[model samples]
Target: MKLLNLQRRMARAVMTPLTHSERMRTVAPDGRSMRAVASQIIKPNDRLTSFERLEIYNRQYWFRVLSAFAEDFPGVRAVLGGRRFDAMAKAYLIDCPSQSFTLRNLGSRLVSWLQKHPSRAGERQNLAVDMARLEWADIEAFDGLREPSLKPEDLAGVNPAKLRLRSQPYISLLALRYPVDDLLLEVRKDSDDLDVASNAFNERHKRKRVGAVAKLNPSAIFLAVHRLDEDVYFRRLDREEFAILSALQAGKPLSAAIESALRGSLIAVADRAAHVEKWFHTWAALGWFCRLEKSPKNEKAASRQ
Candidate 1:
Protein backbone atom coordinates (compact mmCIF):
# COMPACT_ATOMS: atom_id res chain seq x y z
CA MET A 1 0.00 0.00 0.00
CA LYS A 2 1.07 3.61 -0.55
CA LEU A 3 2.26 5.58 2.53
CA LEU A 4 -0.90 7.72 2.72
CA ASN A 5 -3.16 4.68 2.37
CA LEU A 6 -1.14 2.82 5.03
CA GLN A 7 -1.46 5.79 7.44
CA ARG A 8 -5.19 6.14 6.81
CA ARG A 9 -5.74 2.44 7.45
CA MET A 10 -3.69 2.54 10.65
CA ALA A 11 -5.66 5.55 11.93
CA ARG A 12 -8.97 3.76 11.31
CA ALA A 13 -7.84 0.78 13.34
CA VAL A 14 -6.46 2.96 16.10
CA MET A 15 -9.51 5.21 16.56
CA THR A 16 -11.96 2.29 16.73
CA PRO A 17 -13.90 2.33 19.99
CA LEU A 18 -12.88 0.08 22.87
CA THR A 19 -14.91 -2.58 24.64
CA HIS A 20 -16.46 -1.86 28.08
CA SER A 21 -13.31 -3.22 29.78
CA GLU A 22 -11.04 -0.83 27.87
CA ARG A 23 -9.84 -3.58 25.57
CA MET A 24 -9.86 -3.28 21.79
CA ARG A 25 -13.07 -4.37 20.12
CA THR A 26 -13.02 -7.54 18.05
CA VAL A 27 -15.11 -5.90 15.39
CA ALA A 28 -14.30 -2.58 13.79
CA PRO A 29 -16.88 0.20 13.64
CA ASP A 30 -17.23 -0.41 9.89
CA GLY A 31 -18.00 -4.12 10.50
CA ARG A 32 -14.59 -5.41 9.38
CA SER A 33 -12.73 -7.98 11.51
CA MET A 34 -10.12 -6.13 13.56
CA ARG A 35 -7.84 -9.18 13.58
CA ALA A 36 -7.74 -9.31 9.79
CA VAL A 37 -7.29 -5.55 9.55
CA ALA A 38 -4.44 -5.64 12.08
CA SER A 39 -2.65 -8.47 10.30
CA GLN A 40 -2.66 -6.54 7.05
CA ILE A 41 -1.27 -3.32 8.60
CA ILE A 42 1.16 -4.58 11.28
CA LYS A 43 3.97 -7.12 11.39
CA PRO A 44 4.33 -9.79 14.06
CA ASN A 45 7.15 -9.28 16.56
CA ASP A 46 9.02 -11.94 18.56
CA ARG A 47 6.28 -12.18 21.21
CA LEU A 48 3.32 -10.01 20.17
CA THR A 49 1.31 -10.79 17.04
CA SER A 50 -0.03 -8.17 14.65
CA PHE A 51 -3.39 -8.06 16.47
CA GLU A 52 -1.75 -7.54 19.85
CA ARG A 53 0.60 -4.88 18.50
CA LEU A 54 -2.27 -2.92 17.01
CA GLU A 55 -4.31 -3.36 20.19
CA ILE A 56 -1.70 -1.39 22.15
CA TYR A 57 -2.23 1.68 20.01
CA ASN A 58 -6.00 1.25 20.13
CA ARG A 59 -6.03 0.92 23.91
CA GLN A 60 -3.59 3.79 24.47
CA TYR A 61 -5.51 6.20 22.26
CA TRP A 62 -8.78 5.66 24.05
CA PHE A 63 -7.13 5.75 27.46
CA ARG A 64 -5.37 9.04 26.82
CA VAL A 65 -8.48 10.66 25.34
CA LEU A 66 -10.75 9.42 28.10
CA SER A 67 -8.35 10.69 30.76
CA ALA A 68 -8.18 14.06 29.06
CA PHE A 69 -11.96 14.23 28.78
CA ALA A 70 -12.41 13.30 32.43
CA GLU A 71 -9.93 15.91 33.59
CA ASP A 72 -11.65 18.60 31.54
CA PHE A 73 -15.11 17.94 32.96
CA PRO A 74 -14.70 16.64 36.52
CA GLY A 75 -17.83 18.57 37.46
CA VAL A 76 -19.88 16.77 34.80
CA ARG A 77 -18.48 13.45 35.97
CA ALA A 78 -19.55 14.19 39.55
CA VAL A 79 -23.06 15.01 38.42
CA LEU A 80 -23.51 11.82 36.38
CA GLY A 81 -21.38 9.57 38.59
CA GLY A 82 -18.34 7.65 37.33
CA ARG A 83 -19.76 4.63 35.49
CA ARG A 84 -22.60 6.49 33.80
CA PHE A 85 -20.30 9.39 33.00
CA ASP A 86 -17.76 6.94 31.54
CA ALA A 87 -20.38 5.42 29.26
CA MET A 88 -21.66 8.83 28.22
CA ALA A 89 -18.10 10.00 27.54
CA LYS A 90 -17.50 6.95 25.37
CA ALA A 91 -20.67 7.50 23.40
CA TYR A 92 -19.94 11.18 22.96
CA LEU A 93 -16.42 10.49 21.72
CA ILE A 94 -17.79 8.07 19.13
CA ASP A 95 -20.29 10.65 17.94
CA CYS A 96 -17.83 13.53 17.92
CA PRO A 97 -14.29 12.28 17.66
CA SER A 98 -11.38 14.51 18.52
CA GLN A 99 -11.03 16.92 15.60
CA SER A 100 -8.35 19.18 17.03
CA PHE A 101 -4.64 18.61 17.43
CA THR A 102 -4.90 19.36 21.16
CA LEU A 103 -7.20 17.71 23.73
CA ARG A 104 -8.20 21.09 25.17
CA ASN A 105 -10.93 21.26 22.54
CA LEU A 106 -12.27 17.80 23.47
CA GLY A 107 -15.31 19.08 25.36
CA SER A 108 -16.08 21.91 22.95
CA ARG A 109 -19.25 20.19 21.79
CA LEU A 110 -20.14 18.74 25.22
CA VAL A 111 -22.78 21.24 26.33
CA SER A 112 -24.75 20.94 23.10
CA TRP A 113 -24.22 17.20 23.17
CA LEU A 114 -25.70 17.03 26.66
CA GLN A 115 -28.54 19.28 25.56
CA LYS A 116 -29.41 17.00 22.66
CA HIS A 117 -28.96 13.71 24.52
CA PRO A 118 -30.58 14.34 27.87
CA SER A 119 -30.96 10.62 28.48
CA ARG A 120 -27.21 10.40 29.01
CA ALA A 121 -27.46 12.64 32.07
CA GLY A 122 -30.08 10.49 33.83
CA GLU A 123 -32.33 12.46 36.24
CA ARG A 124 -30.05 15.49 36.47
CA GLN A 125 -29.95 16.38 32.79
CA ASN A 126 -30.45 20.13 33.10
CA LEU A 127 -28.11 20.40 36.05
CA ALA A 128 -25.45 18.32 34.36
CA VAL A 129 -25.69 20.47 31.26
CA ASP A 130 -25.33 23.64 33.31
CA MET A 131 -22.26 22.25 35.06
CA ALA A 132 -20.75 21.37 31.71
CA ARG A 133 -21.22 24.93 30.48
CA LEU A 134 -19.61 26.36 33.60
CA GLU A 135 -16.61 24.03 33.40
CA TRP A 136 -16.06 24.83 29.75
CA ALA A 137 -16.29 28.53 30.52
CA ASP A 138 -13.72 28.03 33.25
CA ILE A 139 -11.30 26.60 30.70
CA GLU A 140 -11.96 29.44 28.29
CA ALA A 141 -11.45 32.13 30.92
CA PHE A 142 -8.14 30.69 32.08
CA ASP A 143 -6.24 31.41 28.87
CA GLY A 144 -8.48 33.64 26.80
CA LEU A 145 -7.01 36.81 25.28
CA ARG A 146 -7.22 40.14 27.09
CA GLU A 147 -6.91 43.61 25.62
CA PRO A 148 -5.62 46.56 27.62
CA SER A 149 -8.59 47.66 29.73
CA LEU A 150 -9.53 51.35 29.85
CA LYS A 151 -8.74 53.51 32.88
CA PRO A 152 -11.53 55.44 34.57
CA GLU A 153 -10.23 58.60 32.91
CA ASP A 154 -10.48 56.98 29.49
CA LEU A 155 -14.28 57.33 29.62
CA ALA A 156 -14.16 60.99 30.66
CA GLY A 157 -15.61 63.45 28.14
CA VAL A 158 -16.51 60.52 25.87
CA ASN A 159 -19.65 60.45 23.76
CA PRO A 160 -21.81 57.46 24.73
CA ALA A 161 -23.84 57.71 21.51
CA LYS A 162 -20.91 56.92 19.23
CA LEU A 163 -18.19 55.45 21.49
CA ARG A 164 -17.73 51.76 20.80
CA LEU A 165 -16.68 49.57 23.74
CA ARG A 166 -15.69 45.91 23.92
CA SER A 167 -15.95 43.41 26.72
CA GLN A 168 -12.86 41.40 27.61
CA PRO A 169 -12.51 38.37 25.39
CA TYR A 170 -12.40 36.13 28.46
CA ILE A 171 -15.79 37.11 29.89
CA SER A 172 -18.37 34.34 29.49
CA LEU A 173 -21.96 35.48 29.88
CA LEU A 174 -24.21 32.64 31.00
CA ALA A 175 -27.98 32.40 31.49
CA LEU A 176 -28.66 29.16 33.36
CA ARG A 177 -31.60 27.51 35.13
CA TYR A 178 -29.74 26.05 38.12
CA PRO A 179 -27.46 27.49 40.77
CA VAL A 180 -24.60 25.40 39.40
CA ASP A 181 -21.97 27.93 40.40
CA ASP A 182 -22.19 26.93 44.04
CA LEU A 183 -22.14 23.24 43.14
CA LEU A 184 -19.01 23.66 41.04
CA LEU A 185 -17.37 25.66 43.84
CA GLU A 186 -18.03 22.87 46.29
CA VAL A 187 -16.73 20.32 43.83
CA ARG A 188 -13.49 22.29 43.44
CA LYS A 189 -13.11 22.73 47.17
CA ASP A 190 -13.60 19.04 47.88
CA SER A 191 -11.15 18.02 45.19
CA ASP A 192 -8.58 20.16 46.99
CA ASP A 193 -9.41 19.12 50.57
CA LEU A 194 -10.08 15.41 50.11
CA ASP A 195 -8.98 12.65 47.80
CA VAL A 196 -12.72 11.90 47.34
CA ALA A 197 -11.89 9.43 44.60
CA SER A 198 -13.54 6.56 46.48
CA ASN A 199 -16.32 8.80 47.68
CA ALA A 200 -17.05 9.96 44.16
CA PHE A 201 -18.14 6.49 43.13
CA ASN A 202 -19.39 5.20 46.47
CA GLU A 203 -23.19 5.14 46.17
CA ARG A 204 -23.80 6.43 49.69
CA HIS A 205 -21.35 9.28 49.37
CA LYS A 206 -22.53 10.21 45.87
CA ARG A 207 -26.13 10.16 47.07
CA LYS A 208 -25.38 12.46 49.98
CA ARG A 209 -23.53 14.89 47.74
CA VAL A 210 -26.08 14.65 44.96
CA GLY A 211 -29.01 15.06 47.34
CA ALA A 212 -27.49 18.15 48.89
CA VAL A 213 -26.84 19.62 45.45
CA ALA A 214 -30.15 18.48 43.97
CA LYS A 215 -32.24 20.28 46.56
CA LEU A 216 -31.62 23.56 44.73
CA ASN A 217 -34.73 24.15 42.62
CA PRO A 218 -34.64 25.62 39.16
CA SER A 219 -34.22 29.38 39.32
CA ALA A 220 -33.10 31.37 36.27
CA ILE A 221 -30.13 33.67 36.74
CA PHE A 222 -27.46 35.44 34.68
CA LEU A 223 -23.73 35.14 35.42
CA ALA A 224 -20.37 36.25 34.21
CA VAL A 225 -17.42 33.87 34.52
CA HIS A 226 -14.31 35.99 34.26
CA ARG A 227 -10.62 35.85 35.12
CA LEU A 228 -8.83 38.18 37.51
CA ASP A 229 -5.02 38.17 37.52
CA GLU A 230 -4.55 34.39 37.41
CA ASP A 231 -7.70 33.07 39.06
CA VAL A 232 -11.18 32.70 37.63
CA TYR A 233 -14.25 33.92 39.53
CA PHE A 234 -18.00 33.67 38.99
CA ARG A 235 -20.06 36.80 39.60
CA ARG A 236 -23.86 36.95 39.48
CA LEU A 237 -25.42 39.58 37.25
CA ASP A 238 -28.67 41.50 37.41
CA ARG A 239 -30.94 40.99 34.39
CA GLU A 240 -30.39 44.51 33.09
CA GLU A 241 -26.65 44.34 33.72
CA PHE A 242 -26.49 41.10 31.76
CA ALA A 243 -28.54 42.57 28.93
CA ILE A 244 -26.39 45.67 28.55
CA LEU A 245 -23.06 43.80 28.76
CA SER A 246 -24.35 41.24 26.25
CA ALA A 247 -25.25 44.02 23.84
CA LEU A 248 -21.89 45.75 24.27
CA GLN A 249 -20.09 42.47 23.63
CA ALA A 250 -22.10 42.07 20.44
CA GLY A 251 -20.45 45.26 19.08
CA LYS A 252 -23.17 47.79 19.85
CA PRO A 253 -22.20 51.37 20.73
CA LEU A 254 -22.66 52.37 24.38
CA SER A 255 -25.82 54.40 23.77
CA ALA A 256 -27.51 51.58 21.88
CA ALA A 257 -26.52 49.06 24.57
CA ILE A 258 -28.07 51.21 27.29
CA GLU A 259 -31.18 51.78 25.18
CA SER A 260 -31.66 48.09 24.52
CA ALA A 261 -30.99 47.40 28.19
CA LEU A 262 -33.98 49.57 29.10
CA ARG A 263 -36.48 48.15 26.61
CA GLY A 264 -37.98 45.46 28.87
CA SER A 265 -36.45 46.58 32.15
CA LEU A 266 -38.61 47.00 35.27
CA ILE A 267 -36.32 49.65 36.79
CA ALA A 268 -38.20 52.92 37.29
CA VAL A 269 -37.66 55.48 34.51
CA ALA A 270 -36.13 58.04 36.91
CA ASP A 271 -33.69 55.48 38.33
CA ARG A 272 -32.71 53.73 35.08
CA ALA A 273 -30.01 56.28 34.20
CA ALA A 274 -28.45 56.06 37.67
CA HIS A 275 -28.35 52.28 37.52
CA VAL A 276 -26.67 52.30 34.12
CA GLU A 277 -24.19 54.92 35.26
CA LYS A 278 -23.36 52.99 38.40
CA TRP A 279 -23.06 49.75 36.49
CA PHE A 280 -20.65 51.32 34.03
CA HIS A 281 -18.53 52.69 36.85
CA THR A 282 -18.33 49.33 38.56
CA TRP A 283 -17.69 47.48 35.29
CA ALA A 284 -14.91 49.89 34.30
CA ALA A 285 -13.31 49.42 37.71
CA LEU A 286 -13.29 45.66 37.17
CA GLY A 287 -11.34 46.20 33.93
CA TRP A 288 -14.02 44.45 31.89
CA PHE A 289 -14.29 47.12 29.19
CA CYS A 290 -11.63 48.04 26.62
CA ARG A 291 -11.71 50.71 23.99
CA LEU A 292 -12.22 49.55 20.42
CA GLU A 293 -8.98 49.20 18.53
CA LYS A 294 -8.19 51.49 15.61
CA SER A 295 -8.03 50.07 12.11
CA PRO A 296 -4.70 49.71 10.28
CA LYS A 297 -5.48 52.78 8.18
CA ASN A 298 -6.29 54.89 11.22
CA GLU A 299 -3.26 53.56 13.12
CA LYS A 300 -1.02 54.48 10.20
CA ALA A 301 -2.51 57.98 9.97
CA ALA A 302 -2.15 58.59 13.69
CA SER A 303 1.44 57.29 13.67
CA ARG A 304 2.29 59.79 10.89
CA GLN A 305 1.68 62.65 13.39
Candidate 2:
Protein backbone atom coordinates (compact mmCIF):
# COMPACT_ATOMS: atom_id res chain seq x y z
CA MET A 1 0.00 0.00 0.00
CA LYS A 2 2.82 2.42 0.85
CA LEU A 3 4.68 1.66 -2.41
CA LEU A 4 1.47 2.07 -4.38
CA ASN A 5 0.83 5.45 -2.73
CA LEU A 6 4.43 6.48 -3.54
CA GLN A 7 3.93 5.54 -7.17
CA ARG A 8 0.69 7.55 -7.33
CA ARG A 9 2.44 10.52 -5.76
CA MET A 10 5.27 10.24 -8.26
CA ALA A 11 2.82 10.20 -11.15
CA ARG A 12 0.96 13.27 -9.91
CA ALA A 13 4.23 15.06 -9.28
CA VAL A 14 5.37 14.44 -12.86
CA MET A 15 2.05 15.49 -14.38
CA THR A 16 1.41 18.71 -12.45
CA PRO A 17 3.28 22.01 -12.79
CA LEU A 18 6.10 22.16 -10.23
CA THR A 19 5.97 24.86 -7.59
CA HIS A 20 9.07 25.91 -5.66
CA SER A 21 8.19 23.74 -2.67
CA GLU A 22 7.39 20.79 -4.94
CA ARG A 23 10.62 21.32 -6.86
CA MET A 24 12.64 20.89 -3.68
CA ARG A 25 11.15 17.41 -3.16
CA THR A 26 11.74 16.27 -6.77
CA VAL A 27 15.09 14.70 -6.09
CA ALA A 28 17.20 12.27 -8.09
CA PRO A 29 17.36 8.66 -6.92
CA ASP A 30 21.01 9.42 -6.07
CA GLY A 31 19.77 12.21 -3.62
CA ARG A 32 20.08 15.28 -5.86
CA SER A 33 16.90 17.36 -6.06
CA MET A 34 15.38 18.74 -9.33
CA ARG A 35 16.72 22.11 -8.24
CA ALA A 36 20.14 20.49 -8.44
CA VAL A 37 19.21 18.78 -11.70
CA ALA A 38 18.17 22.13 -13.20
CA SER A 39 20.95 24.29 -11.79
CA GLN A 40 22.07 25.29 -15.27
CA ILE A 41 18.59 26.48 -16.22
CA ILE A 42 18.28 28.59 -13.05
CA LYS A 43 20.81 31.35 -12.95
CA PRO A 44 22.84 31.99 -9.79
CA ASN A 45 23.42 35.77 -10.06
CA ASP A 46 19.78 36.64 -10.88
CA ARG A 47 16.91 37.52 -8.56
CA LEU A 48 14.43 35.40 -10.62
CA THR A 49 12.57 32.71 -8.65
CA SER A 50 12.19 29.03 -9.56
CA PHE A 51 8.93 29.93 -11.36
CA GLU A 52 10.87 32.22 -13.68
CA ARG A 53 12.97 29.28 -14.96
CA LEU A 54 9.81 27.40 -15.97
CA GLU A 55 8.24 30.59 -17.37
CA ILE A 56 10.81 30.51 -20.17
CA TYR A 57 9.20 27.33 -21.51
CA ASN A 58 5.76 28.96 -21.43
CA ARG A 59 6.94 32.02 -23.34
CA GLN A 60 8.83 29.85 -25.88
CA TYR A 61 5.77 27.65 -26.51
CA TRP A 62 3.64 30.66 -27.55
CA PHE A 63 6.51 32.17 -29.55
CA ARG A 64 7.08 29.10 -31.66
CA VAL A 65 3.37 28.76 -32.45
CA LEU A 66 3.09 32.46 -33.35
CA SER A 67 6.21 32.22 -35.50
CA ALA A 68 4.74 29.21 -37.32
CA PHE A 69 1.53 31.18 -37.90
CA ALA A 70 3.48 34.15 -39.28
CA GLU A 71 5.31 31.81 -41.64
CA ASP A 72 2.06 30.21 -42.83
CA PHE A 73 0.29 33.53 -43.41
CA PRO A 74 2.97 35.91 -44.58
CA GLY A 75 0.55 37.57 -46.98
CA VAL A 76 -1.90 38.10 -44.15
CA ARG A 77 0.85 39.70 -42.12
CA ALA A 78 1.69 41.99 -45.00
CA VAL A 79 -1.92 43.05 -45.41
CA LEU A 80 -2.57 43.65 -41.72
CA GLY A 81 0.69 45.47 -41.12
CA GLY A 82 2.99 44.68 -38.13
CA ARG A 83 1.04 46.10 -35.20
CA ARG A 84 -2.39 44.91 -36.31
CA PHE A 85 -0.96 41.52 -37.22
CA ASP A 86 0.46 41.10 -33.74
CA ALA A 87 -2.88 42.09 -32.20
CA MET A 88 -4.78 39.72 -34.44
CA ALA A 89 -2.36 36.90 -33.72
CA LYS A 90 -2.79 37.35 -29.99
CA ALA A 91 -6.58 37.46 -30.28
CA TYR A 92 -6.62 34.42 -32.56
CA LEU A 93 -4.46 32.44 -30.14
CA ILE A 94 -6.80 33.29 -27.27
CA ASP A 95 -10.02 32.46 -29.10
CA CYS A 96 -8.70 29.24 -30.60
CA PRO A 97 -6.18 27.63 -28.31
CA SER A 98 -3.69 25.19 -29.73
CA GLN A 99 -5.19 21.67 -29.81
CA SER A 100 -2.46 19.72 -31.54
CA PHE A 101 1.03 18.94 -30.36
CA THR A 102 2.52 20.42 -33.54
CA LEU A 103 2.10 23.93 -34.96
CA ARG A 104 0.69 22.59 -38.25
CA ASN A 105 -2.88 22.64 -36.92
CA LEU A 106 -2.65 26.19 -35.60
CA GLY A 107 -4.22 27.89 -38.61
CA SER A 108 -7.00 25.34 -39.17
CA ARG A 109 -9.67 27.69 -37.79
CA LEU A 110 -8.08 30.91 -39.05
CA VAL A 111 -9.87 31.21 -42.38
CA SER A 112 -13.26 30.53 -40.84
CA TRP A 113 -12.61 32.93 -38.00
CA LEU A 114 -11.54 35.64 -40.41
CA GLN A 115 -14.73 35.11 -42.37
CA LYS A 116 -16.78 35.88 -39.28
CA HIS A 117 -14.81 38.99 -38.32
CA PRO A 118 -12.93 40.24 -41.32
CA SER A 119 -9.77 42.27 -40.84
CA ARG A 120 -10.38 44.52 -43.80
CA ALA A 121 -14.02 45.41 -42.80
CA GLY A 122 -15.05 47.01 -46.14
CA GLU A 123 -15.00 45.89 -49.77
CA ARG A 124 -11.70 44.09 -49.22
CA GLN A 125 -13.32 41.75 -46.66
CA ASN A 126 -14.31 39.18 -49.24
CA LEU A 127 -10.94 39.45 -50.90
CA ALA A 128 -9.17 38.99 -47.55
CA VAL A 129 -11.32 35.97 -46.74
CA ASP A 130 -10.54 34.42 -50.09
CA MET A 131 -6.82 34.99 -49.62
CA ALA A 132 -7.01 33.34 -46.19
CA ARG A 133 -8.70 30.32 -47.71
CA LEU A 134 -6.09 30.11 -50.44
CA GLU A 135 -3.31 30.29 -47.85
CA TRP A 136 -5.06 27.57 -45.83
CA ALA A 137 -5.27 25.36 -48.91
CA ASP A 138 -1.55 25.78 -49.47
CA ILE A 139 -0.84 24.77 -45.87
CA GLU A 140 -3.27 21.84 -45.91
CA ALA A 141 -1.88 20.57 -49.22
CA PHE A 142 1.55 20.39 -47.66
CA ASP A 143 0.27 18.41 -44.65
CA GLY A 144 -2.26 15.98 -46.18
CA LEU A 145 -1.69 12.33 -47.10
CA ARG A 146 0.22 11.66 -50.32
CA GLU A 147 -0.72 8.43 -52.05
CA PRO A 148 1.27 6.69 -54.77
CA SER A 149 -0.14 6.87 -58.29
CA LEU A 150 -2.46 3.97 -59.08
CA LYS A 151 -1.01 1.61 -61.66
CA PRO A 152 -2.63 1.59 -65.13
CA GLU A 153 -2.86 -2.19 -64.85
CA ASP A 154 -5.19 -1.82 -61.86
CA LEU A 155 -7.79 -0.08 -64.06
CA ALA A 156 -7.35 -2.49 -66.99
CA GLY A 157 -9.52 -5.21 -65.39
CA VAL A 158 -12.11 -2.90 -63.77
CA ASN A 159 -15.75 -2.90 -64.77
CA PRO A 160 -17.23 0.61 -65.09
CA ALA A 161 -20.82 -0.28 -64.09
CA LYS A 162 -19.89 -1.49 -60.59
CA LEU A 163 -17.23 1.13 -59.91
CA ARG A 164 -17.30 4.10 -57.52
CA LEU A 165 -14.64 6.76 -57.41
CA ARG A 166 -13.25 8.94 -54.59
CA SER A 167 -11.45 12.25 -54.69
CA GLN A 168 -7.81 12.62 -53.68
CA PRO A 169 -7.23 13.67 -50.05
CA TYR A 170 -5.64 16.96 -51.03
CA ILE A 171 -8.28 18.23 -53.47
CA SER A 172 -10.72 20.97 -52.45
CA LEU A 173 -13.24 23.00 -54.44
CA LEU A 174 -13.99 26.62 -53.58
CA ALA A 175 -16.58 28.88 -55.15
CA LEU A 176 -15.89 32.57 -54.49
CA ARG A 177 -16.40 35.93 -56.16
CA TYR A 178 -12.98 37.27 -55.14
CA PRO A 179 -9.86 37.08 -57.25
CA VAL A 180 -7.84 35.46 -54.41
CA ASP A 181 -5.36 33.55 -56.56
CA ASP A 182 -4.29 36.67 -58.38
CA LEU A 183 -4.03 38.63 -55.11
CA LEU A 184 -1.85 35.98 -53.45
CA LEU A 185 0.56 35.98 -56.41
CA GLU A 186 0.67 39.77 -56.29
CA VAL A 187 1.37 39.83 -52.53
CA ARG A 188 4.17 37.25 -52.92
CA LYS A 189 5.94 39.60 -55.32
CA ASP A 190 5.60 42.37 -52.64
CA SER A 191 4.34 44.94 -55.15
CA ASP A 192 0.54 45.04 -55.22
CA ASP A 193 -1.82 46.27 -52.52
CA LEU A 194 -5.41 45.20 -51.80
CA ASP A 195 -7.76 47.74 -53.45
CA VAL A 196 -11.17 48.16 -51.84
CA ALA A 197 -12.42 51.19 -53.77
CA SER A 198 -14.82 49.78 -56.38
CA ASN A 199 -17.89 47.65 -55.70
CA ALA A 200 -18.72 46.51 -59.24
CA PHE A 201 -17.12 45.60 -62.52
CA ASN A 202 -17.57 48.10 -65.41
CA GLU A 203 -16.26 46.18 -68.39
CA ARG A 204 -16.03 49.25 -70.60
CA HIS A 205 -13.82 51.16 -68.13
CA LYS A 206 -11.97 48.00 -66.92
CA ARG A 207 -10.68 47.20 -70.41
CA LYS A 208 -9.18 50.68 -70.65
CA ARG A 209 -7.07 50.26 -67.50
CA VAL A 210 -3.56 48.81 -67.91
CA GLY A 211 -1.77 46.04 -65.96
CA ALA A 212 -4.74 44.40 -64.18
CA VAL A 213 -7.39 46.88 -63.06
CA ALA A 214 -8.47 47.11 -59.40
CA LYS A 215 -12.17 46.44 -59.93
CA LEU A 216 -14.25 43.85 -58.13
CA ASN A 217 -16.22 41.68 -60.54
CA PRO A 218 -19.45 40.15 -59.24
CA SER A 219 -19.16 36.95 -61.31
CA ALA A 220 -18.90 33.69 -59.40
CA ILE A 221 -15.73 31.67 -59.96
CA PHE A 222 -15.26 27.93 -59.46
CA LEU A 223 -11.82 27.10 -58.17
CA ALA A 224 -10.04 23.77 -58.04
CA VAL A 225 -7.52 23.84 -55.23
CA HIS A 226 -5.12 20.92 -55.39
CA ARG A 227 -1.49 20.00 -55.07
CA LEU A 228 0.47 18.36 -57.88
CA ASP A 229 4.13 17.35 -57.61
CA GLU A 230 4.36 19.00 -54.13
CA ASP A 231 3.28 22.46 -55.38
CA VAL A 232 -0.17 23.95 -54.80
CA TYR A 233 -2.17 24.86 -57.92
CA PHE A 234 -5.40 26.84 -58.17
CA ARG A 235 -7.34 26.90 -61.41
CA ARG A 236 -10.60 28.64 -62.25
CA LEU A 237 -13.05 26.46 -64.19
CA ASP A 238 -15.96 27.37 -66.47
CA ARG A 239 -19.54 26.64 -65.36
CA GLU A 240 -19.93 23.34 -67.25
CA GLU A 241 -16.54 22.06 -66.19
CA PHE A 242 -17.31 23.04 -62.61
CA ALA A 243 -20.63 21.19 -62.70
CA ILE A 244 -19.04 18.06 -64.10
CA LEU A 245 -16.23 18.05 -61.56
CA SER A 246 -18.65 18.76 -58.72
CA ALA A 247 -20.76 15.81 -59.84
CA LEU A 248 -17.72 13.56 -60.05
CA GLN A 249 -16.70 14.70 -56.56
CA ALA A 250 -20.17 13.68 -55.35
CA GLY A 251 -19.45 10.09 -56.54
CA LYS A 252 -21.70 10.32 -59.60
CA PRO A 253 -20.51 8.16 -62.49
CA LEU A 254 -18.53 9.71 -65.34
CA SER A 255 -21.43 9.35 -67.79
CA ALA A 256 -23.86 10.98 -65.37
CA ALA A 257 -21.54 13.90 -64.69
CA ILE A 258 -21.07 14.35 -68.41
CA GLU A 259 -24.84 14.34 -68.90
CA SER A 260 -25.19 16.91 -66.14
CA ALA A 261 -22.47 18.99 -67.76
CA LEU A 262 -24.44 19.11 -70.99
CA ARG A 263 -27.96 19.27 -69.52
CA GLY A 264 -28.80 22.97 -69.89
CA SER A 265 -27.10 24.53 -72.86
CA LEU A 266 -27.31 23.78 -76.58
CA ILE A 267 -23.78 25.17 -76.91
CA ALA A 268 -22.32 22.39 -74.67
CA VAL A 269 -23.97 19.59 -76.71
CA ALA A 270 -21.16 19.13 -79.20
CA ASP A 271 -18.39 19.46 -76.57
CA ARG A 272 -19.85 16.96 -74.04
CA ALA A 273 -18.33 13.81 -75.50
CA ALA A 274 -14.84 15.25 -75.90
CA HIS A 275 -14.97 17.01 -72.51
CA VAL A 276 -15.86 13.77 -70.70
CA GLU A 277 -13.03 11.87 -72.38
CA LYS A 278 -10.48 14.58 -71.66
CA TRP A 279 -11.64 14.94 -68.03
CA PHE A 280 -11.12 11.24 -67.38
CA HIS A 281 -7.61 11.42 -68.81
CA THR A 282 -6.90 14.60 -66.85
CA TRP A 283 -8.07 13.16 -63.50
CA ALA A 284 -6.07 9.98 -64.10
CA ALA A 285 -2.90 11.88 -64.98
CA LEU A 286 -3.32 14.25 -62.01
CA GLY A 287 -3.97 11.38 -59.52
CA TRP A 288 -7.16 13.11 -58.37
CA PHE A 289 -9.35 10.01 -58.15
CA CYS A 290 -9.09 7.26 -55.55
CA ARG A 291 -10.67 3.78 -55.74
CA LEU A 292 -10.57 2.94 -52.04
CA GLU A 293 -13.36 4.14 -49.74
CA LYS A 294 -13.05 4.40 -45.98
CA SER A 295 -15.99 2.65 -44.38
CA PRO A 296 -17.81 3.51 -41.15
CA LYS A 297 -15.80 0.89 -39.29
CA ASN A 298 -12.60 2.71 -40.29
CA GLU A 299 -11.62 0.01 -42.74
CA LYS A 300 -10.83 0.73 -46.37
CA ALA A 301 -13.08 -1.05 -48.87
CA ALA A 302 -12.03 -1.32 -52.49
CA SER A 303 -14.72 -0.60 -55.09
CA ARG A 304 -16.22 -4.00 -55.88
CA GLN A 305 -18.19 -5.29 -58.81
TM-score of each: 0.90, 0.65
Per-model CA lDDT versus the true structure: 0.85, 0.61
lDDT of 2 by residue, 1-305 (tens): 37787555433333333233324244534454555434533454467655356445545555666788888886565445555666677667657767898778888898778777765324445655666677888777766776665545555545453345666778777776766676566555443222542313322222233113226575677887888888888878667777777877887765566667778855556776686677667777888776544443113122343
Best by lDDT: 1
Task: Provide the clash count, candidate 2.
Answer: 0
Model 1 CA deviation exceeding 4 Å by range: 195-206, 295-305
Candidate 1 structure quality by residue, lDDT tens digits, 12-48: 8998998878788889878999999999989999999
Candidate 2 Cα misplacement greater than 4 A, ranges: 1-46, 49-58, 119-123, 150-162, 191-215, 265-267, 291-305
